[model samples]
Target: MASSLTKDSAAPGTPGSEKTFFGHPRGLATLFMTEMWERFSYYGMKALLPLYLVAPGGLHLNAATATAVYSVYVSLVYLLALPGGWFGDRVWGPRKTVAVAGTVIMLGHLTLALPSSGTFFAGLGLVAIGSGLLKANISTMVGHLYDGPDDPRRDGGFTVFYMGINLGAFAAPLVIGTIGETVDWHLGFALAALGMALGLGQFLIGSRNLAPRSTVVPTPLSAAERATTLRKALIWAGVAAVFYTVVGVSGSYTLNWLLVPLTLAGVVIPVMVLARMKRDKELDGTEQSKLSAYIWFFVAAAVFWMIYDQGGSTLSIFAEASAENSVLGWEFPVSWYQSVNPVLIMALAPVFAWFWLALNKRGNEPSTIVKFSSGLVLVGASFFVFLAPLSIAEGGHKAAAMWLVAIYFVQTVGELTLSPVGLSVTTKMAPAKYASQMMGVWFLAVTAGDATTGLLSIAGVDLNKMGIVALEAALAAVAGVAIYMYRNKVKSLMGDVH
Candidate 1:
């Protein structure tokens, strides 16, 4: 009787269908648990990294140097997504790639749990590679859970999924970063390893419910897919060889190594894809126009990213230097401030989701382009919340913690407005053949942004003073002008697609 009930529950579309629970899948819960823990580990390690470098017995590197290195690390993690996406499209299906990547990430966390310089670098390498694979693919899997393109449940599902991501991110730093500061670094790293293990376990268990990838070649790959994949592999291999020479000769490969090729690809791939589309004669005029619009938005997003991604580099250093913290008669560790944005995200995502839906129903919501532009402006504005306190902190005094918290609260709302919507926009706008590659191109902007952040760190900006305010104001003004000038065109391009 129990076996019969289990089989019924697992079956596709009965009253107890495996595909849904309150307008979502029971499987989503499992993936939620999986992603939550994965984020916990990622954020836990991140929280301690800058602190680890500058602590008394730590690397003893200067602030500028360490932030640059940290930016390089973060940038590499995103830039590698090109190959990771290609690997999913060609060698392994997205699901299998996710599993393999999760295991690799787990190993990376464990590697950092040891106390040796060699282990640190090695672990960083592994984590970067693993993040490349897992980050792109797991999100891809969330879309895979639905059977059709216009599934109503899809948007809600991703919101729930993003909540899980923030849940882990919000909790990990507080728990693991605190432990590292109070107890030991190894224990914090060990916590990361454990978190990843939980994510991997949940992912494995839920694998049975995931829908198969649309691009998975059941028989054998067509000549085109195979040829494209082979070219991609060769391109990746060339990138690796160049990095090998860079590290061998200079003892350090700058973050720019990852950006160079990706930047080129971002330019070239769209042209190549359009050429292919023209040759096939398969795309209609509307489809072609939509693709063109996507390219434009990608360009705008690249500009926005130049400011948005400062969080891990310039903003991080600012927090380390100036943010005030005191709790329970102990000053909170500066790194703990990183938790602020994630915590706000966890609490506010649902509200924003509902708000968008409600506005949509009333025909009163902003268009996608407007929303993106607003996000850019808001991100810029969020930086200024600290301007007063920062200006006053010049003599090594701490700035008020409320300033940072205020910034995060506003910035997280901006994040909700932009991020998931951007993901959905890309998937909707891209042609089926170029979908995965275009997603990779989207990330190239992030790589460029991180590279720019690194360069800014090298410039020695006085982030605790008017510098941050000037930078923020500049971003807001540029974003506002761009959006205002392009308003009609941007709205036309969206063409009721949102």
Candidate 2:
């Protein structure tokens, strides 16, 4: 199986063949910086959302409603990746889709800077739509920079790329959170807009560094077929418009209504995708086996993310209400706590990358599934660690800030193990024609977990408490063990992918 997965050559004079940046493709630097700035905008805005919603000068929503809204907003950001990927794969290609989406995202931030409820929700909608377009396709483009399934550098590339993502995430909360929390919320949003604009400019300037394959439209449709596709898309657009208009006019709409359907879609869409792939005549036996194994990875990722994603919602609430706000005589904003994971990720990603590469050199690297299982266990342990401090704190008393920091640190470790590897594996396993679309499917796992995060937050499940924390820890532990027990079977199903 290992022999079957040997690296293949990239064509000469292509981006994939060049190793101009840290021994990886030069294009990686371009994608890295692009993602960094995009994440800066995205996380910066997110850090402000929960606080802004409950602020007197902002939306004035309650905790439950705000968390619910946050969940829905984040879920949609990933959910929209499905169509975004399809559009890139079949229509505009990754480069153009990212450009258009970046513009739309900037507009969304601008709209958010306005002090009107209508504009606020509308801005969230636009951002969600834009993110759906950019997120998966950008990742797909990163995967394209590698030559084949056996590229030893593939995981390392994604790890480095993930570092770029965290670079943005690390700075965003400190800058934007300070402004939003200490100065004006709208100004913070404007800063986010500026970040996106700068990212767009950089991406455009460096567009030439991208792989030629990143801009190729896979399975391009003929003119007549395209016309038919456009007609169907417009019809769906009309239907969506009518539905939204009715809901808006009724004034009875709530985040719960949105959450129900989104959650269902998260579960159902993956099942449908797997079913279709299984039945596809285009996939070979090995491809089918790899896809089957991917489902296990997908489930593990979803479970891990559901717990980890509380960083922005439930964890935010904890920081605001239950965690000590003062650090070394400075009263840090609760939103700043959101930066902890990113900061740790930036510090730790390179170490993790080197660790994996060293192990691979010794032919002793854990299978992808093993790494994923280990991630789940670590994340579950994070909850238990949180419980240790909370269990002793008196009711209505704030816990130490270090407790939350420790939790974020542990969770960051889990993330390093699972997230980038998941991205790399998705690229390795997906059928070539459905590459972008499959990236969207990978994001759907995150969507499911994010939607679940919203549900738990709305239900007032506390991560700091014994009940919920214990439950999550137990579930993650069990899942990890189950996956480990089945590791051999999964590897066999993966054929040469391990």
Candidate 3:
């Protein structure tokens, strides 16, 4: 549901004599709003998914099953971006990919607007494919609009574009979430579709300002090569469709079965790649040592996300089941709690940015490993907020919303602590030849952690509320402590990375 892939990207669109948006580029405004609505679709559904699964009028799935489904769906969404990046770089180019991908996403949401279990599965697949296609390329296109890395407008432009994403994220639950909770879930999905439609339309109109590079494939295929690739892809697609149809007809297939392989893939793919990089004859001693250090950071990042990203799963469930959703005698949807994190990020993220900058200026900043450890500790400690609610809110009583809000705020700070630095550090620490792949490696940490989250729920579905929160808190705290205890050793492995 979150991404480190595009977090550190440049911004703006084609610059020239064209009038700019917010003093950047007109193309930026287009992409910014397009991304905004696309995210609205994504986060809106995220807010509603678990509740809809368990609703009497909905899928009627149990809590653990629904959460697992959500987690796997999220994990796949990120994983597919790897291929998406390749497609944009080699085949369709970023512009065409974005336009087509946006349409697919809209259609997926429209499919979800229908009321059927079969449509639900198909719709999720479409959305995941579309999201994968759009995820990395759109950001790539944003970078293309700039005049390269030295473009002064790049950072500011990306900052504005980033706001678009968070704006959609912050507003989604407040708008679509309320409708889903009070009106109907299908109707909510339809609105998500409409959001994508609006974004796609705007993008089509405004993409004229996009740079020529938008359509340039970094690796183009010749006619015969293209034909061969398409043929093989179609063959594979046909085989998959047949397999799915046969499995569905047998009534022996569960979504869980797909998850087992996917969960393994999330961790395994990165491990295999990192191991290859470590053993590559092309690298020297320093690069190899950095990889060793990176592996430690990778594990830490996975643990951090495993704990932080639970805001939408078990935490959301806790809010729905045990926390108050009313104020001044006016009841609100529990899904609104999902918005708290983004809004806090919007408000406090700048403060964190300035604070870290000031520390750097004063030469008082903590080392990267220490910052990561701090993030782990803080995020883990946020889990303890649930302790009070679990203690006093016995039986059917709901706890105050402020406790959850506090947890989200602290977690946001923890997020700011590690995530912003994690991306840059990974890039800086990787061997020169492995620069790009290191970005993918950074993302794999997120995917692995997210998949692990679902796997744990599937394995520990019977865990009590108290036990669950306690375990999460303890796991993160212990990881943080362990990482801190060996910080000097990790730093040594990092060599000159700092």
Candidate 4:
């Protein structure tokens, strides 16, 4: 199945065409740089968020509360992608949706640069909502760059694009983390706003390189339909406004207040999407089967992210509190640890791309399920590796920085197997009319994982590293086994797809 997907993906294009940016469509370079800068802003803020929340001059929240807030923020960032995806598919298209979202995100960073707690929370909300608009659609646009499933460069293109993500992620912590940790948190956020400004500028300039198809609305509604949709949107917005007003007026606008609703949405949205898709008379049996397979893949991805995303929450705290910070002579900022995964990704992505290409040539690549299961196991093992140093340490001794680095290295390998492949597969499996919507549905897995991470944070799991590691390892093992056992059945459902 994997070989078949690869074969179709690698089909040759017109021989006489000129290669523009590393033998890819010229638009790829534009998307790559735009995504890089967006991530620079996103991750720059992300690297500092939890630390800032608990810092002496900032919120001064406890680690558990801080993690809870971080989790909810990150979860919403992905969850809101549902509406963003819908808007792109049905209304504005990816180009306009992304441009608008970028502007919102820049404002979000600027809001964070303010010192008031009210503005801080408001900033988080804006960033989360804006991220939903951009992340999935940008990825959707990346997939569209290829002519079809037959574009052999599809997976490779995504890998290169994934490198752009890592480039921004790699630089953010080093730049923002350093200033935020050493200088001032608000200054770090200001820098994040600056990053987004650069990205928005680049996007406006380079977006024209994209194929005209990228701007095609998949489902254009009639005037009456548009009116009804607008009415419903306004009603929802009014309700949300009232709720927020009440919370603000009551002085109850805390992370705990936000957590419950976001968690519920994480569970509810996927169910609603699945139900809607199942009932759609337009979809045939093959599409239904593929959608069913995608649900399981979604579950697998959620599990992987729940474990992986701890890097920003529990892991960051661990880096600050329990891990040795000194390297050679100078002490490093804890947020710098966030860069380790991206650094590894930048270094190793091309190798994984080549490895997959080689496997495809030999017709020996494992199925997507196998890769996902392996990724789960690798990430699971990372927790155990993280647990080891903590277990060995005695009398409140701090673990060496190398332990966290080792954990991130292992997790990055798992990410390489799962993340880019997941993106490619989602594009492959989605029904034509529901392309952007399905992409949004894919992000719901991250939403669920992130929400779960937040719940765990509120439960104070960070205080017990060994217990958390053990729990994660066990859960990952079970999920991996289940996926492995059902791999063949899922592949069969995928029909002609890998």
Question: Which stretches of model 4 miss by more than 4 angstroms?
Answer: 1-19, 23-26, 140-157, 212-218, 244-254, 279-282, 360-363, 392-394, 431-436, 459-463, 495-498
Predicted structure 2: lDDT: 0.82
Q: Give per-residue lDDT, candidate 2, residue 20.
A: 51
Q: Score candidate 1 by TM-score against the native.
A: 0.82
Q: Give the clashing pairs for model 2.
A: none
Residue 54, model 2: lDDT of 75
The local distance difference test score of each candidate is: 0.71, 0.82, 0.83, 0.83
List RMSD in Å for every model shown.
Answer: 4.6, 5.6, 4.3, 5.4
Lowest-sum lDDT 10-residue window in model 4: 1-10
For residues 10-80, could you state the per-residue lDDT of candidate 3 as single tens digits?
24235432466666766787888899999999899889888888788889887887777777778888778
How much is the lDDT of residue 361 in candidate 1?
98
Candidate 4 colliding pairs, count: 2
TM per model? Answer: 0.82, 0.87, 0.92, 0.88
Cα error of candidate 1 at position 238, Å: 8.2
Q: Tens-digit lDDT track for model 4 on 1-498? A: 111212121223422123355667766777888899899999989999988988889899998888888888888888888788878888888888899999999999999999888788889988988888897688878877787878777878887888889889999999998999999999999999999998888888877767677788877777999999999989999998999899989987866666777776776777787789878989888899898888888888988998898888878877777778878767899999999988888889779978998998999988888898888888888888878767755447888888889989999999999887788789899988787567677778888888887777766667446786788888887888888998889899888888
Error of 4 at 155 (Å): 5.0
Q: What is the total number of backbone clashes in candidate 3?
A: 0
Candidate 1, residue 123: Cα displacement in angstroms equals: 1.6
Order of quality (TM-score): 3, 4, 2, 1
